[model samples]
Target: MSDTLTPPMQSADCWTRREIWQQPQTLNETQRLLRDNQGEIERFLRPLMEKTNLRIVLTGAGTSAFIGECLAPWLSRETGRRVEAVATTDIVSAPDLYCEGDTPTLLVSFGRSGNSPESIAAADIAAAKISDLHHLVITCNPDGALARDPGTHSHVVVLPKATHDHGFAMTSSFSAMMLAALSILSGVAALETRIDAICQAVSDILHNADTAMADLAQRNFSRVVYLGSGVFEGLARESALKLLELTDGGIVTAFDTPMGFRHGPKTFVTTETLVMVYVSNDPYTARYDRDLIAELRADNIAAGIVTLSAKAEADDTIAVRNLGGACDADLLFPYIVPAQLFALHASLARGMTPDTPNATGTVNRVVQGVHIHPLNP
Candidate 1:
């Protein structure tokens, strides 16, 4: 890892590194942008949210789709609405199954480029299937289809330009979109209160975690497993995908909830596996996470077990320094930093380009070669 951050300012100046390092600033800008636009957000959402039985469906493809999974549970509790995460890929493939025809629905679509065929198809399908449909598009490109072509029944929140990551694997785009969705859906004012701690923690991770992650990357673990619970499960999935994408499939990855792993996925682990657990801040959930970690350690089959946590649990814990008392939802932003760094380092160690790691041109930044079928009864 020649470019591995001793100076934290490599002469290469890759977009992947720039985007990964820029998260703290991008997140602050996202919150600020939301706060400034609070009036419009409330105006659009207030009425729909006030409806007797509204359904909020968060939908997108790939990394964008994971945003919904990460936020749906917390936002559902915060808003007391039926908030659900349905991937655009799923919605497009089987709109009849996921879309409720008569429901008063609000669709929050997340997209970096906003041009994925599935993303556009998902919105059209939702609109066609639901009678009272509203769209809230959170996207990076102002000129993107989702931002520019949203019909009169929609509102689009265009994130700061920096979040439109040029890299194949999403780094800043993931965090910024997740932050934007949380602030808008949960009340920007409320998130405003906690923004400083989240931003500071992320900044600290960027400043400090780079070298250690690089060192870990050089260890040459052929397999990696990421485990967590509830919202952290979604984070685990994103973390696994980051490594898979950045390493160009050179490193195999799996993601599961701490408890879910015992059911059978645990069989995937081997002597060459490196396991990372994203420990939940909730006491009850943390116990389950810790139990799994302990069980894996006792078995001693895996090469390593690392815990990403706000509270210290072991010698290998990558502590976020602050935010010990923060809710698990708040921990999401900072918890992802170490995973993002490791993926970047692993890509470099494997001699792949962090910005465009898929050498085969099979996987794309924005997916290609999909035929949209007629959604007929």
Candidate 2:
């Protein structure tokens, strides 16, 4: 945890643990990078946005894809335009269904390495299918395929180098890319005033929740379920993936909206399960989140239930500091910290290396064995 990052209490050799701890620094740097490049970004996006019918499709794979999922609804309302989250894998496999040849579209690609086969194939498929389209590549790796060859009608925003996690599971990389997209699509200046509060909250969570989440890991809960509403739903999915990935499938995980969980999914819980909800900050949405948490508490089925909230109103929430007033979108950054830490700790508790948790080579850092089948002519 050198290079301006806070020291890690875990093994200094664990890059994954350090990556999770480095998010505050990475997010802050991402914001600054966007600020410095706002002018150029505006020049690229302004004309396309003026079309009034420009469709924004956020695409990636795995955690990167979830970035779009988390922000799609919020971005849609904020931009007053259609914003959809479609994974690059889906686009590659079924390009005709996901790609619109007629509509003016903006393909927003989020990638840490920007080198995934599906990610590359998805972009090519979009370019081939969409007649009026533009590409926005938000990636951490400046040398990745997405960044290096962002096409003729594309612009790439390479984040701070620190975000390119050398570790197998993405920690800082996930938060950094999601934050970058939120700032870019919503407007960089909107976040200028809010960045400090978000960063401080994240730093605080890293320190405050460290011991508790690690303690939870020691229990060795066999299953974990994450619940959220609105923007957090995508976050919930990402959180579930983080745990499953970090623990190398030793821990099965699931995710859903608090309300949606009742539709038979709640049956997955057992005495060995741990349920964690990313409580929404929106007044109306928070009600549903709290309601579900209460229902789960009353059911008393799971081994444990944790609520990650920015508001102090919720008793026993791993409350994030200084951002209660922040929008649900803003809360995403800090809210993910505890889950990230928990996953790392869980990996360590299982006697696996957090840096490369997977014992088998089935999954590579930048996905592998993906034969990009030719798009049928």
**Steric clash pairs (candidate 2):** none
Stretches > 4 Å off in candidate 1:
1-7, 314-316
Task: Give candidate 1's TM-score.
Answer: 0.97
Q: Looking at model 1, which ten-residue stretch has the lowest summed lDDT?
A: 1-10
- lDDT tens digits, residues 164-216, model 1? 99988888899999999999988899999999899888887777777888888
Which parts of model 2 are misplaced by more than 4 Å? 1-3
Taken over the whole model, the C-alpha lDDT of each candidate is 0.89, 0.90
Scored against the true structure, residue 228 in model 1 reaches a CA lDDT of 81
lDDT: which candidate is best?
2
Taking all chains together, each candidate's TM-score versus the true structure is: 0.97, 0.97
User: lDDT score, residue 117, model 1?
Assistant: 98
Maximum-TM-score candidate: 2
